[model samples]
Target: MTRLRLLDATRHGALHLDRARGGARRRLVPLGRGEIAFAAADMPLCFAKDAQTGRFELVALLALAGENNLFTSPAGYHATYQPRAAGLGALRLDPAGADGLAVDEADASLGGAGDALFTDGSAARWQAELRAVVDDVVAGRALAEVYARRGLLRPLRITLTMVEGDGQVLDGLYVVADAALAELPDADIVAMHRADELAPAAILTASLAQVERLRQLHNARYPQQIATIGLAVAD
Candidate 1:
């Protein structure tokens, strides 16, 4: 597995981020707290364990059952609000990466045709934004981890109701457990709120409401759209 590799100008100075028709097929997008306040409103946000690290991180579901990204068109993201990590192009956030940053050296868009990643032996102008995005992701993961250890997370399963009738079932996803949160003593909730962890946790469960929006988006984009997405939970 490719571990987190930091961005080094000398090693990857020739890289360029391509934001054209590429990456439209992205399904799960790394979503961080920096944009969570808005993203929670636009897309269905949840947590899924990373294949390499086996750690849960917040993600925006672009599509419920397909590889194609519903929020993104071939030209680019069609949503008015976009995840901060989406702006990084090939350089998505990785926990193993130093400072929560990593570069896809093999990204098809890195061959100097698009925006240059490095200029004059220093990071390019856009990297400042990338650093900010990664910072939020790193910080947000800290709070997300709290949910894992504190019994605030529960496995998520969703059934799709489409024009074709029984559609795909997506499982192995996680969401904040509101019932568990209600069970916690007042002190713990207050502590989490003081530490700025409680709200985003609430945001995760609240974001589930956007699954209907997902159906709407899919319906608007595809020839055969979906009617609804039935959600089920396993504690």
Candidate 2:
């Protein structure tokens, strides 16, 4: 793993990794007596390590408007952009970023704390869970076929929902899957929605199969909380 270093915005900065080196050798354009902006033109350009395969990687943190910030790869791939707000945690790359994750709404100093959770383990865990659910659905166990037809399994549409208290609410989540069975029953829909009961905190729904997988994973993670709610599978 490549640890990120905050280079001085004034002097030329470079990061040498095991396989690659990156740095900004740009001319410092003075924004103020205390702050200076490094123009990309003067910076030493570096390539981004493959996120999917490379064990070492580097990213640049850029300051944004209104105490907000953006994280991008050295190659300029936008990883995440966050802004400060009252009541709401920093706006995340995704909608559910605010729920399960604790965010500092009033404190700007706490910016990167919540960011680590999204970066370190939670993201990988969620992706693995999603893959497992997709595999299970494809094996013909749950209503995966129906969900694929209803635009409920599409990646763009799939979202994480946070449930407050003991209340239940019906909200639409987008997912990416093949279109096949659009005619789904109301009872089955209810079962799918109720699976969000796992933590009373948040749920990620991509399809009926995803819901089932979430329930099972949630149960395994929180056996005590799992006892409080009942999750039904549509037959």
Candidate 3:
């Protein structure tokens, strides 16, 4: 009789839970579609609900534990209540499971990674354009600004460190692509970066064309691996 609830920071919403069974006849609750926050591949979660009050509670049991004492369950659930002394915070659910949870307080302070992006007045126009590009990538459509918004679009920014010229030092660059562009590959990404080029920071303002190109490059270079791009929006 276990139920679950999902508090997703990405979509900034809640989701209904689905029921399931894990090992040992334990009941499990799955989150709904698009219910995750940032990265789905590394953040699995689970929860149980009180039959009477109907308030869903996060389950603290760890399906997988690491040497560092970090624990991981399925997606949509969090282990925040666990003690910080245990070093278990380093444990992550599947990246695909990152939905339905807020960025942990510890993670929020690490600006380059694990942070969400915000936008303000000065960057509003660029933000709108980036959002359209993201929408197209998520929808599996081609990129055309014909239906794009004229002004003030809010898009997320994802940054990553790459060895650009000689692999001497890591160059941190921002990719102002749609949030959905996280799965794209590097070569194709290279092209998109060229197109959606942002000034001062060289962040790529990705569009559908850029996503497609990145996908092709990704397939050619690293076929089996998935890439995660960090996101930060303007305030």
TM-score of each: 0.79, 0.19, 0.17
Q: How many steric clashes between backbone atoms does each model show?
A: 0, 14, 41
Best by TM-score: 1
lDDT of 3 by residue, 1-235 (tens): 2222222334322321111111112222222212222112223222233468543322222221111112223332233232111121211222232321222223212133221232221222323433443343333111212112111122333333232311111111112234434444667556655754212112113221222232233333432422433335443
Query: Best candidate per lDDT, number?
Result: 1
Candidate 1 TM-score over all chains jointly: 0.79
lDDT of 1 by residue, 1-235 (tens): 1233577766777767765533456777787777778988778888888889988888888787687777766455567677767656567545454334578665544566667777676554555677787788877677678888888888889998777786889987888877888999899889999988887877777888988877877887777767777898886
How does residue 105 of candidate 2 score in lDDT?
31
User: All candidates: CA RMSD in angstroms?
Assistant: 4.2, 21.2, 20.1
Give the poorly placed runs of model 2, Cα more than 4 Å off: 1-167, 174-207, 227-235
* lDDT, candidate 1, at 205: 78
